[model samples]
Target: MATLQLSGVCKSFGTTPVLHDIDLDIGEGEFVVFVGPSGCGKSTLLRLICGLDTIDSGTLTIDGEIVNDVPPAKRGIAMVFQSYALYPHMSVASNMGYALRLAGTPKAEIERRVEAAANVLRLGPLLKRKPRQLSGGQRQRVAIGRAIVREPNVFLFDEPLSNLDAALRVDMRAEIAALKQRLGTTMIYVTHDQIEAMTLADRIVVMNAGRIEQVGSPLELYRRPANRVVARFIGSPRMNLLPGALVGDPAAAEIGVRPEHVRLAGVGHGLAGTVRMVEHLGSDLFAHVEIAGVEERVVARLDGGREVHVGEAVSISVDADTSHRFDAQGKRMAPAHNDRRTA
Candidate 1:
């Protein structure tokens, strides 16, 4: 495991800047996940760290050693890409130890490392099988085993499960979680999947438009986003935004209420709206209500067994204590001293 530091990091492609002045610190053996939409430069940052690409300007330190000039082979970092890229003709054992063999390692050492990695990944029984003979999940394990055999100081994963089906992704996610506990190595994962970021990361780094938006534990980002961008991105179904004027706060720009915090009330009780649609999941139900003045439909989470029908007229109320207020610039607004429940 290794600690990593990035100071004043900046990068660009020709005239377009891809990463701004970014600074971050990662502790030894910590799992940090980078999350952002496409074109947010998360992958570029990973490439810079792994020596696959040159940093435009910044200091990248690994275990107190500056490695800006280090080659990929000497960086003591192993990266698992989205594509397994396993050689079809080679057996699992040969594929796992390919890097060591290329570096002129002793045959005995390579075999020992391969065997150990296979055992840890539960791939020992399939060592003699070719890539074509294994399932997708098994092939991914082999890719992970390849990285494990190197015993690198840090591991980098760039959406390693993107190619798998939904069920395989979940199963692979569990295996990766178990791997983290078993190996206790520093890991940096990049993904657009919220569940992966929330479950696998010790802390999540949220990026947007070439800048670091927020870095915090999953719940921190979900409950107290630094800005509107983060507030809108962290949750599933997303937080519903209503104009502040509708809630007796004309001074504020908008109020954010999570779906779970929104209540469907009797007609004429609160904001009047029409239910546009209803979704029934196993444990929860969601209603999309279209208020007269609100531009977008507001989503409300209800108990699954509760009956709600599309086109039904309903009133909605937001819990003032749990709701959030934002200023015109999209910054969170503090609650008034006179009322803790009001923003």
Candidate 2:
């Protein structure tokens, strides 16, 4: 495993700057994920770490050694890309050992490493099968096994599961999680999917338009976002925002509440609105409410069995104590160092 540090990292393309003065530290054997929407530079940042691209102005150190000029092959890092990139003609064993073979590893050592990686990935039974004979998930595992054989100091994954279907994606996620436990190697993953980041990362680096927005553990980010961007992005249905005036807070521009926090208030108690729609999942029902002054529809999460219908008049209340207050500039304005917003 290796520790990675990026100080004042900046990158650009022609006249358009991508990554700003970014700084991050990754501990040895840590699983850090860079997550954000497309055009956010997550993939570019991964490429920079893999030495596929150069940092315009920054110091990238690995294991406390400055490797700004180090070649990718010498960086002790292995990267798995979105594409499987396996050779169709090569058997799984050959594909997994190809890098070692090219690196001039002895044939016997290559065989040993291949066996070890296959054992780790559970690909032993399929070693003789060509890429064409393997399933998509199996092919991806082979690609990962290819990297595992090298025993690199760090592993970098760039949206490796995005190409798979939803079910396969979930399966691959479990497999990758198991791989992390089995190897305990330093892994940096890049994904636009927040769920992937939340589930896979020890720390998630949230980015927006090439700049790092926030970095925190999954629950820390979900429960206490630093700004509106993170508050709206991290959640599955996203936190709902209403004009702070509704909460009688003149200093707050917006009052952010999660769907789960938007509870059903009694008649005329809170915002009087009509249910726009209701989405029933297994255990939760999300009701979309349209109010007079609110721009976007307010969505409230309730018990799935609750029989809410479209066009039904309802009153929904925002739990101020469970809500967040944001300044006009969208900065979180908690009352104290650790205090959340309260009525």
The TM-scores, one per candidate, come to 0.96, 0.95
* Cα lDDT computed for each candidate against the true fold: 0.91, 0.89
Candidate 1, residue 70: the lDDT equals: 99
lDDT of 1 by residue, 1-343 (tens): 9999999899999989999987999999999999999999999999999999999999999999999999987889999988888999999999999999988999999999999999888999999999999999999999999999999999999899998999999999999999999999999999999889999999999999889999999999999887787888788888898998887677779888889989898788788889999999969999999998898999999999998999899999876677888999989898533332222
Q: Among all windows of ten consecutive residues in candidate 2, which has the lowest summed lDDT?
A: 334-343
- Scanning candidate 1 in windows of ten residues, the lowest lDDT window is 334-343
TM-score of predicted structure 2: 0.95
* lDDT for predicted candidate 1 compared with the true structure: 0.91
- Candidate 1 residues lying further than 4 Å off, grouped into runs, are 337-343
Q: How well does candidate 2 match the true structure, expressed as C-alpha RMSD? A: 2.1
Error of 2 at 78 (Å): 0.7
Off-target runs (Cα >4 Å) in candidate 2 are 336-343
What is the per-residue lDDT of model 2 for residues 1-343, given as tens digits with 9 covering 90 to 100? Answer: 9999999999999989999999999999999999888999999999999999999998999999999899997899998989988888999999988888888999999999999999888999999999999888998999899889999999999999988999999999999998899889999999988899999999999999999999999999998899999899898888999887765666789888899998876568777889988899979999999977788998899998888888889888765578888999999997423333322
